[model samples]
Target: MNERPRGIESVLVVGTGLIGTSVALALREHGVTVKLTDQSPGAVRVACELGAGDEWEPGGDRVDLAVIAVPPQFVADWLLDLQKTEAARFYTDVASVKALPIEQARRLGCDLSAYVAGHPLAGRERSGPGAARADVFLGRPWAYCPGRETSPRAVAAVLSLIELCGGNAVKVDPVAHDEAVALISHAPHVAASAVAARLVGASDTALGLAGPGVRDVTRVAGGDPDLWTVILSGNARPVAEVLEAVATDLAAAAAALRAVSVDDDGAIARVTELLRRGNAGRSRIPGKHGGPARAYAVVQVLVGDRPGELARLFQVAQDAGVNIEDVRLEHAPGLPLGAAELSVQPESAEVLAEALRSHGWHVP
Candidate 1:
């Protein structure tokens, strides 16, 4: 937080699903008066019970801002209705697909002057208010796409909301936002689902050999299918375009693999070239603070699968004055031991490793 943000002391959060409830909870943490509502009264009650906000009524007083967190298809209609009633001075939506919503708003003849479309590039596999967390948006990119008719005041208020929620606001055009998300978020989620779909009725013997890599690759596939179906449908064309490109690459890789059996001279090169391109693409993903990835030295330590093991290891690193930049845990099946991979600065790696070794931890 570079500066203290000030805007929208009171907010009406429409749709108390995961994103809405999370935004409400985040706003609540910043002392904003959050009034929550959803189509389902039970959802609103759950969010309110979680201290996200108070249950909003139909004819409540106009608030400084209103956040519509409904699915993409309904965002325009919600914006239209809210603006018609002057429910808030300014409004924004958290739907991931931006272009369609903005276009739909235009088609519906809604007032866009006070509305900005936004999408926070952060979420959990779980949906609903019970899965919402105040810190979910911390350090994540919150994109706001202002239409041609949007007012500067509305944009500023949206930026303030993003800041208050501990997110970095990224200003982008609506169509460009859709394309970018389609490539990164939407396409990848569908790809993950496709991969996970292969596991249906898979043998236990095959699944037993799985490791962290498979889990990481298929993690997003666990998201709600109905919700994702709506998301994929909203951004269909862009997502389809990206998926087509991916399918082409995958088809080529498979062909190259098949060629290997016939002893084709170029088969290995073809597959290797695809792998190299994948490495290049993976490296291009932004790291901390939307910057280039930094090389951190990983210190691996074998630990007993017991309570307080990770805490003790972290405490050791703290006492050694070595800040662990990141951490990943590895579980050993059918064994009471696992490995903790601690990422630290190159200079501190040896110090942290030595500290753990001194604490009777196996640094293998």
Candidate 2:
């Protein structure tokens, strides 16, 4: 990336949370002066301490760009207030939903020509300054939604922001961006929470029998509920539409399961077809770096619970001359061994498994 975005020497990040700090840190790395601010002084202080950027000072030098990273509900008001000052030449936001904020800003009579809306389709299950990483946007798509009357300079500035963070800039309309995210992000979050919610009143025995399948489905459900509530509220319509479609599928699956349990005719075929459709839908998801999904082979190994075991496993895998695509670890209760599942390119799985066993590691 360029050392600094053209004509953008300094940036004022208006929130010090995860996304805000990440943007500041990434910009600072490329020689852009950045000022960090938040409603809470302590939050800004922590972000600064983490080397995201310098603390914002009153009457400081004006910035070339100002990024409003506040919550969805406060975005319009904050943008309006910032526009009233000569704080920045170009204004953009990292809010999850774009259309509502843009509409609100228009109603508030904000300078439409100087503003654009952007959202990075990336995040961790964690939140806050503590979880911020400069590389969070790498290999992610950052959607840029400029208002109809937005100027070329404003669009370029926001595009530079995305490039500086190592993200691909995907130009999209505000309404289209909202709908896409509802299907991919917002609705999935709600679904994950629903799956997790089922465990709240589950019996201890049922919980004990859970495995990676349950854990995977409910992982994002651990996110901050308060923040999710605000986001869901902001993009309520699109999210509701997506959830309604999902509910229809859920009803079909439920009815099929009930019919199968009763040995009804064609019940097995109905269940199988639903499962096949699920496989098809899941296969459409892009693989690493937005490429077509590739099937990987999993090689499971039982390793002793000892110091340096994981490092040794990796060393052996490297010695086998196979690249590992992914990995997972599962520990058995009251056992000294844990299962390490390594996912490699399908053609190399058996070779890697044999090599690991040849090196005295149990491969199952």
Q: Write model 1 residue lDDT over 239-354, tens digit each, in one string.
A: 99999999999999999989998989788798899999988888776432222557677899997765335655666887899876555556655488887777677799889888
Best by TM-score: 1
Clashing residue pairs in candidate 2 are none
Q: Where does model 1 exceed 4 Å of error?
A: 1-5, 288-364
The candidate 2 region of ten consecutive residues with least summed lDDT is 285-294
lDDT (Cα, 0-100) at 328 in candidate 1: 54
Candidate 2 vs. true structure, TM-score: 0.79
How accurate locally is residue 269 in candidate 2, as Cα lDDT from 0 to 100? Answer: 78
The top-ranked prediction according to lDDT is: 1
Off by over 4 Å in 2: 1-5, 288-364
Q: Model 2: C-alpha RMSD to truth?
A: 7.6
lDDT of 1 at 344: 75
TM-score, every prediction:
0.80, 0.79
Provide the lDDT at 304 for model 2: 80
